[model samples]
Target chain A: SAVISQKPSRDICQRGTSLTIQCQVDSQVTMMFWYRQQPGQSLTLIATANQGSEATYESGFVIDKFPISRPNLTFSTLTVSNMSPEDSSIYLCSARVASGGRGIQYFGAGTRLSVL
Target chain B: AQRVTQPEKLLSVFKGAPVELKCNYSYSGSPELFWYVQYSRQRLQLLLRHISRESIKGFTADLNKGETSFHLKKPFAQEEDSAMYYCALSNSNSGYALNFGKGTSLLVTP
Candidate 1:
């Protein structure tokens, strides 16, 4: 299990403003992922953050709207650019920890963003 | 493409009653299935995995490859079991990330 933390646990922002959510892991991980959970809905993978490289965004999500930066193995950030009311959602960060023969993924306490 | 499907959006059961949460997957290759639980105000955590074949918190799930299903089941429900449950799948050979289903909210009432 990994101890992960996210900054700005909850935030309210005006429309058209951008916010960057930070994810910090207690130990180095092989993979880091970003997800978005709409109210009363399921989680959607936003992107997969790769250290020292550009992140891979999922279908329906673009780099220009949600830019990601993973400078090191233990830290990553996702910036919601030019936000709108529809962009309000719980953003979660997860990491894969090597264990046994395979690895298990763990999630951070999500950042709940409310775009007004 | 790998995908997970949880049929129920909400399920309610009384304490000591049996509970079952259905989950199905669509993937061509071998899949690693998992059940994740989120309690109120707590971070989501892994409850159990099909590969491990270990029961956690009196919950057990068996992978039926023929049916492409991994349903979570328990004989007796408890009040503490009220929470959100998500079914996830990962390609055995693909990267270690998961494709999650729309979670099911379980309400175990006394």
Candidate 2:
């Protein structure tokens, strides 16, 4: 399994300000995903970041609101643009491990964002 | 539409007692199921997957395609087993990104 590291484990931001979260995997992986977990809610898939290409966003999510980047196999970034109070949640970074056979996704510790 | 449902929001049990966490999923194709656990102040980690048919930390889950469920179970509950458990399903069409349940908070008391 690949170890994922997320920067800025927690942050507090003002409304209308955007925040970018970084996810780094210890090894090269084929698939990277971004998920948002609202307070008292289940984790929802935001998008799948494809290496060397634009990310595929899930329903109810747009690239403008949550732009993603995967420049390489071992790294990806997700930015929550034009933030609001509702945007406050835990943002998780996950990767499909090459060795985990059958593409098991491993998650990062997640970034807790509080918007006021 | 692939979805994972964990009916119970929380489950409390006495230590040394048997414990079962129910999980149900909806998917048209053959799905892969998994159980993930998050201990206090720790990252979410994979506890077990149905394909492996292996028990992890005294816990095991059987994928019943007929019933559309993959409930996790343990013979004896341990205090340290208390944590947030999430049941997930892998949709082959979606690059294997997990569809997670709402999660069940298990509490083991003395």
Candidate 3:
């Protein structure tokens, strides 16, 4: 398991503005992910951050809306572009690490974002 | 496609009482189940995974493949046990990411 640190625990942004959230892991990992939890909803996978390559996004999400960057093995950033009131949610960063042939994912504290 | 379902949105029980949070998932491949908990003002943490076959904080969940369910149970609920519990399914073949249920909010009143 790895410890993750996310910056700007909470932020308030206006519609059409964009905000970037940073995620740092204590240990290097192969797979890092970004997830969003809307109010009163379950967590949804936004994208998978790949080191030194473009990210892979889920069906409902797009790179233009939620751009992701994995600069290295231990750090990644997710930028929510063209923010809207509907984009308000808790954004969490997670990393998948291998342990004894098992893959386990640990999550960060999450960034609470509100788009006015 | 993989999907996880948690039927109850909120469950209230008195302290020392037995508790159970139901979870059901739909997946085409072999299923991997997990329970994640989030206490008030706390980060979400893993409670237990089906593969580990272990108990945490007096809670245990058995994977029932036939039923496509992994329900979390506790013989005696404690005040500290009250939290939002999420049931999730992992798709190993798909590479990364997890499918999470809506979650259950447990309330243990003393």
Interface RMSD of each: 1.0, 0.7, 0.7
Which window of ten consecutive residues has the lowest lDDT sum in model 1 chain A?
A49-58
lDDT of 1 at A93: 96
Order of models, best DockQ first:
2, 3, 1
Candidate 3 Cα outliers beyond 4 Å, as residue runs: none
Residue-by-residue lDDT tens digits, candidate 3, B10-89? 99999999999999999978877889999999888999989999999999999999999999999999999989999988
Winning candidate number (DockQ): 2
C-alpha lDDT of residue B69 in model 2 = 95
Best by lDDT: 2
lDDT of 1 by residue, A58-115 (tens): 8899999999989899999999999999999999999988777777989999999999
Q: What's the i-RMS for candidate 1 in angstroms?
A: 1.0
Per-residue lDDT tens digits for candidate 3, residues A7-112, read: 8899999999999999999999989999999998889999888787789998999999998889899999999999999999999999988865777889999999
**Tens-digit lDDT string for candidate 2 (B49-101):** 99899989999999999999999999999999999999999967988889999
DockQ of each: 0.82, 0.89, 0.85
Displacement of residue A88 (Cα, Å) in model 1 is 0.5
Spell out the clash pairs found in candidate 1.
Answer: none
